[model samples]
Target: MSTTTKTNHIGRKISRIRELRGMKQETLAEVMGISQQSISHIENSETLEAEKLGKVAKALGVTKEGIENFSEENVINYFNNFNDNSFSNSQGTFNANNCTFNPLEKLMEVVEENKKLYERLLKAEQEKNIYLEKLLGK
Candidate 1:
């Protein structure tokens, strides 16, 4: 018996990224000014023209290279490693730079956890502010 592995396929890569982004063919089609059928066809083909690929990349909010190099395993590995909370060495002490913690991810988690408090603070700040509307011609 022989075993074979398929290499990267541009169309499949596009479909995967689009699906991961929670987008539907209809939505992508609308944004690209093409019919949903066209989007389906594009997703099934192995190659796409550079110009058309640019349009698809723009609609999906990613660069063309991102779509071309998309790898599900790599993405899964990234998320899995990101969820790992162990930041200590064998001595059980935190690293000086906290290499295991992603600052942007932590910031986003904090923002989400305090959404209501943030909204309230913004409202209070706005209420305490004073603004005057000047007459247009005066």
Candidate 2:
């Protein structure tokens, strides 16, 4: 059996990382001040210049070394071994139970209350205007 080694294609790595980060090519191009065609050409290329690579790294929010060392297998392994429990260990610094309510839900409730209050205030103003109009008619 022949053992074929995988080539370290930096462009592919950048494309993959950008995709994983939920960024479109146009977005990356805008961030790098380049055109979408340029981004596409870069992704299609197997190699890139150091300066261009540095700029791409910055646009992609990764270090040059990170781009060079990126691999699908490594990313998969990282996600597979990822754990959220590290945020709260035996240390008292972090307490997950400290948040008694969902902030988003609370904000929604406040928004709804404000909307109701605004409607009530609008109705009261309309009634006052109607009363003033009736008094002036006399």
Candidate 3:
């Protein structure tokens, strides 16, 4: 006979991923149209309803499976792999058949572009909040 151990704590996983992504409970609550206390309750539970989990996953900018399968060790491994020097040459370029490839440079360019996109998204969210506050003032 085999005993199955339930090791996946969905709520804690959600909280950890949220913190890793630099998101606060208040921000997640605003996106989910819930209260901060509600977010707190969700984070303390071992399991979540499928619908609410989906909502939380969406608000956190990750898929439900991502939250379910997240492991801190895996994230650390990914960072270590990313920082490995073997991926780059001494000149920071890849040499292949008389062609020099600098994929790291290209990756950095995309990362910069993504940063700009996130900044725009944050600005838009702030503007929307300001507009909502004005509506509340009326």
Backbone clashes for every candidate come to: 0, 0, 0
Per-residue alpha-carbon lDDT of model 3 for 26-121, expressed as tens digits? 999999999999999999999999989999999999998888889988788656655333334235644334536688998999999999999999
Please list the residue runs of candidate 2 whose C-alpha ends up more than 4 Å from where it truly belongs after superposition.
Answer: 87-138
Q: Kindly provide the TM-score of model 3 when superposed on the true structure, using C-alpha atoms.
A: 0.57
Let me know the TM-score candidate 2 reaches against the reference structure.
0.61
Inter-residue clash pairs, candidate 1: none
Ranking by TM-score: 2, 1, 3
Model 3 off-target regions past 4 Å? 1-6, 84-138
Residue 92 error, candidate 3, Å:
21
Clashing pairs in 2: none
Q: Which candidate number would show the highest TM-score if scored against the true structure?
A: 2
- lDDT agreement of model 1 with the native: 0.84
For all predictions, the C-alpha RMSD in Å is 10.0, 6.0, 16.0
